[model samples]
Target: MIIVIDGLNKHLFGDVLDEVFKLRARVFEGRLGWEVNVVNGRERDQFDDLDPAHVVSIDDEGEVVSCMRLLQTTGPHMLADVFSSILDGEPPLRSTQIWEATRFCVDTSRLGQGRAKNSISYVTSEVMIGSFEYAQKAGVLDAVAVIDPVMNRVLKRSGNAPCDYLGTAKPMGKVTAMAALMDCSDERIASIREFAGIQHDVFLSEADALRLMAQRQEAKSPMPKPSVANQDHKPLSTLERYFVEQMRDARTESEVQDVLRLIESLSDTFTPEQKDALLNTPRAFAQEA
Candidate 1:
């Protein structure tokens, strides 16, 4: 189940926000005992307010399935701040090319659920694609992710690898013990986007990529400059952020759907009756992520 809740600057505070928190508490604290505290039914942390986070995927029935927290190099980040040693002091970020990736997890119950369809790994691929597309949208030239040893293979299969600037990988003496930086290439990034099966292009469309360098140069000028003002820059709000975090703790599709209804309803940007329609609708099933 992957549901991306975008365009929410107008409804940041209200009961809708409260529902997000409730969803977090129900999933993270109630379903999974992963957090140290659950005050007032919201799972929060020091990093939540700082990073530019987004809730990309939710389980079927609208519960969060997998979420990621992305921090740009222009600001303080885990790699540059707490894990500076991991980069060997060169600073992994060189440009608007972002160094991101952290706090990635999927619903526990969904694990091993899709092993049969080859989509068993599809959810993880969606996260990878989302991250890549997000980086491209931000004008990022490079992306770096610190992943557990087992998942490192996943990234590797996706054509990402450790960078020299990323220092050394740590070993925990098990298949999942090591953590390494996964560096993606432009082509690989495109592949990631294509794999996700989304409609949007990342940096360049397939047709654009097929164009010769000279043709690309010719196509560059005389076009209306794209305006970024209409674009969204802020991270998810306190409420929306919590809904994403809850997915890491969701164990069932019903629970996930329960959260989704609240999200759609609370997105009060819709008409009252539209909200009613969203609430009154039956739950939809998502292929196991």
Candidate 2:
């Protein structure tokens, strides 16, 4: 199923966004050899900070299988700010009715090959259908996408090919990139749906999506047993308890250091041993427990 998230409701879908960015890092940076900013294994760019809408496809396991980023062309966008060379010095298209779609990718490595809805091919078309449907509802008239020749062919094969071309293709890292435009209309959406053999609504309820996400996370790694220290010792200080909880949830080295830094900010209150115990004991016991 697909989940459409915008800047306004992003706080309610943190886990979904995490998986989408990680998938982008895997596909665009790790696999495609693209030069992009990847922090903590997540591919993100300046446009992400601009609060663009995201169309994400989730599997039954609640994993994000495919995602596409959407941004309004009235402001700074890929074609206007980054890939302007493709326009050959002509003014970049700027209008509220037109939007820019970039960072379009699918997690093919995990989904593998098939014609099923969960398969890469089906999910790709599904994302396309979701994007067009979403834009049309928001009063967007057309969409301009920065894509490579490979993606252009994929769109053609999926029966959702671009309606027009902008500028000549230019070298972008290992692959050449060009701009393609497509109208946002029910006819285009219907064509993609017919091609993909999907006739039902492609969205999941927010509550159901969160439940599936929780299930996926639990299946990957079960939660550790609670710390016995809380039961044996007296109640902890607010700072110390917060520190220990952060340690329990820390998933990366950077996150661990962030917790340590927070503890250090309260150095006047916590003794060195107290700080050490908060950091070491919880994680060590979590593994053994």
Candidate 3:
């Protein structure tokens, strides 16, 4: 399953974003030893604040196994901002039709080596398929990604060879970074899908995605009890209570995810404790039911 987190639906995916960051930390900092900003087990940079779209892949168990970031080239992005050095003094490519893709990674510990279910090859292709499909639908014509030689080979093997290269490969830390351009077109997507043996739509409905996300989150660690979640705990707002009640009244898993997304989206305006209470309401309902 795949879920896209953009500015519009980002609020519904705070937990998914959290896992994405951790996965980046594990791959970029831990394995690749790349020069990245990892704080408290999350890899992040200024580009994250620019509201880029994130294409994420989860397993049947609802665990976020892979993810990639997308930002319009017209705005502040990785290649234009932090990684402008890759241009080798040339100007960064900026256009509404072109988007930058970066921070592509998969959970190696959870996935195996072969191109099977829960395999690195499987999720990698799924992420590539999801990224191109997503960019194309968003009116984007191309995608620029900062990758190393290893990833370059993977792209070639998967039939997603870069159409062009922006600049020379430069050493970042222990590894080298090079900017590669790929087209977001039907032909390109079809080739990658065919290579990966993918024959179905690579998307999970927003409701189903949220539902899947909750399953993984609950499995990892239950939310802290509200009393100890924050010292200055505040009561839920009236509207917040309405959302929580709606979550309790939800009948199906789809409806549960929908109402939970609604409650979470509205939670940022309230206190931390209030948000916790809103999200934790579902568990409380399960207890009562």
Per-residue alpha-carbon lDDT of candidate 1 for residues 1-289, written as tens digits (9 for 90 to 100): 2322223321222222333445556655666444434677665555556635443444333334456556666776656665565555565564456656765656555445543212436666666666666566667766666565656666666544455325666542332223354455667656654554544422222122212221322344242221222123333233333344333244687666655655575565444543432344322111110
Provide the lDDT at 60 for model 2: 85
- Residue 242 CA displacement from its true place in model 1, Å: 18
Give the lDDT ranking, best first.
2, 3, 1
lDDT of 3 by residue, 6-66 (tens): 9887756776899899999999889888888999999999989989899999889877899
Off by over 4 Å in 1: 1-43, 89-94, 115-120, 158-165, 171-186, 193-289
The residue pairs in collision within model 1 are: 1-58, 3-58, 58-65, 61-257, 63-256, 97-141, 114-120
Q: Is candidate 2 or candidate 3 better by TM-score?
A: 3
The candidate 1 region of ten consecutive residues with least summed lDDT is: 280-289
TM-score of each: 0.52, 0.76, 0.78
The sequence of per-residue lDDT tens digits that candidate 2 reaches over residues 142-247 is 9999999999998898889999999899998899999999999888889999998989888886545645665665566544344654444444544454445456
Provide the clashing-pair count of each candidate structure.
Answer: 7, 0, 0
User: Could you give me the TM-score of model 1 versus the true structure?
Assistant: 0.52
Candidate 1 — what's its lDDT?
0.47
Q: Give the C-alpha miss distance for residue 231 in model 3, angstroms.
A: 28
Question: Model 1 RMSD to the real structure?
Answer: 16.8
Task: Point out where model 3 deviates above 4 Å.
Answer: 217-289
